[model samples]
Target: MAARDYGQYSGITRAMELVGERWALLIVRDLLVGPRRYGELGAGLPRIPSNILAARLKELQAAGIIRRAPRSRVIVYELTPYGRELEPVVLALGAWGFKALDEPREEQIITPDSMTMDLRTAFRPLVAAGLPATAYAARFGVAELLIRVEGGELDVSRGDGEADLAFAAGPDIRRLISGQLAPERAISTGVVEVLRGRGELLTRFASTFHIAA
Candidate 1:
């Protein structure tokens, strides 16, 4: 059973009952990236209290949104098929929330999983289909990602690699993604520092991954 009841029969209410708790959707967000051990989940969400993490995991398991399975001889939590259905929903929610993001508070930290999803959310597949295949080694705060775009597909993974462009940005990369900051301006102002590759590819990156403000 869900942990709470609102005495309403609406689907929205039921969904809220299942995942509306603080940090519950964030757990789902990370799992959407891939399976994670309990410790890994905790590490990804360093702000969540350990007890709350344990309780949320139990509630999610009970609700059948996630399950534990043996992976490489270690148990990890992964989304069930039904839970995977939330991917588009989570992506849409991320896009909707993008407009509200300003600057990151000092306590906020970016994680690879979160950045992966953010790229997925902002990917313009049709636009990318017309562009040359591109690879980017990007850093947002401490998180490093290798991003590749070919045709209408995007692949993002942790760590660095050879790339057409390499750059580092803080949370202000949102400005570039939202088209509020042009590539030239971003580089000139130090909002993004080019570590390697041609600076012009940053324009392609901006065009390929954008969310209109």
Candidate 2:
């Protein structure tokens, strides 16, 4: 599929022309983390129709934003170097959008990529620095995400392993990050389950990332 031509000389318009299609930027968002097979990408974007997803992928590939490569004898899609340069743009948009997250509505669904990217946008290195290095495995039923804070750096990845804490993603987790729900309440209410690691780690972990008010 061909991208729309905005016919505007502005760089912003040209950039938008490439990504303005529905699910285009979102596809890029999911690929920002790492290479993903078609199935993996579909998992992250459950709402997008398979046909639309395929079309968007074709458009992006043609535009040089992504490329297909063989990984472990299987094909996977990943962003090109030029595409990876959109990191700052994506993070900036994520940070700006946080203040609008008053409360998650019934219709609002949080995907693993959205959750992981939000953490990347919300991470406070100074706050993580004051706390001991920690790792967390967050499960969202559809997928599990690994978040690690070490030496004042934050890393978010797919898959799961041993961690300082683990919890199911839900309203309570959302509220906690937004500073609406307290850790104590989350535990007492059983909204978050501890699968491994010390309970105390949750407090420090909560402090490290916050959705903008």
Candidate 3:
């Protein structure tokens, strides 16, 4: 580490304060795909300065969000299980940031979490442990969707046609699911668009999601 004049924040405050910087989220985003060597993470995030990267990684380690292990002769930075648990939040942030960016015509191929894949991953954690959906369907458009239940997992897609529950939330599914915006409030405010679903089924599906505090 260089002899830079860093501010005197307390250990925990310092850790949170470090990640509070601009490029810190991007550093974690690189790690979310999997582990990476320092250079690889640097390359993936072009805008981050090398020194800043090192500093953030150090802070993340200090905070117990990441750790490095030896591979071959070099060490690799990987998220701790504690850090990996933040993947949903990271994905949510990515989606939200993309929406705030410039026009849709840019054709930038950045995908945070796939709607189809989210369905699969979300169910694996809660409902369907092993098997794939017995029946699956989706109606893809500007806002893609997938409703599926595999093995024993059941999730309704947020598209047209019959759904046990429909989510017509425009742009911010994460906010709604994360409980930042109450589901009923979102529906009432016209922020999220929901479709048909029985009360029992809605309760069952809500159990599967991981909402943020």
Query: How well does each candidate superpose onto the true structure, as a TM-score?
Result: 0.98, 0.88, 0.44
Better of 1 and 2 by lDDT: 1
- lDDT string for model 2 (1-213, tens) is 456887779989878877789988888988887889999999888888999999999988988999999999999999999989888898888888776766567777777788788888878898888888888998865658899999889998878988879877564476777777788777777777777777767677679987746
**How does candidate 3 fare on TM-score?**
0.44
Model 2 CA lDDT for position 213: 65
Order the candidates by TM-score, highest first: 1, 2, 3
lDDT of 1 at 61: 92
Clash totals for all candidate models: 0, 0, 8
Tens-digit lDDT track of model 3 for 12-105: 4554464666666666766765678998877666667898888888878876788998989999999899788777876666445533444335
User: How much lDDT does candidate 2 score?
Assistant: 0.82
Which prediction has more favorable TM-score, 1 or 3?
1
lDDT of 1: 0.94
Candidate 2 root-mean-square deviation in Å: 2.2
Report RMSD (Å) for each prediction in the order shown. 0.8, 2.2, 9.2
- Please give the distance, in angstroms, between residue 109's alpha carbon in candidate 1 and its true position after superposition: 1.4
Model 1, position 191: C-alpha lDDT score? 98
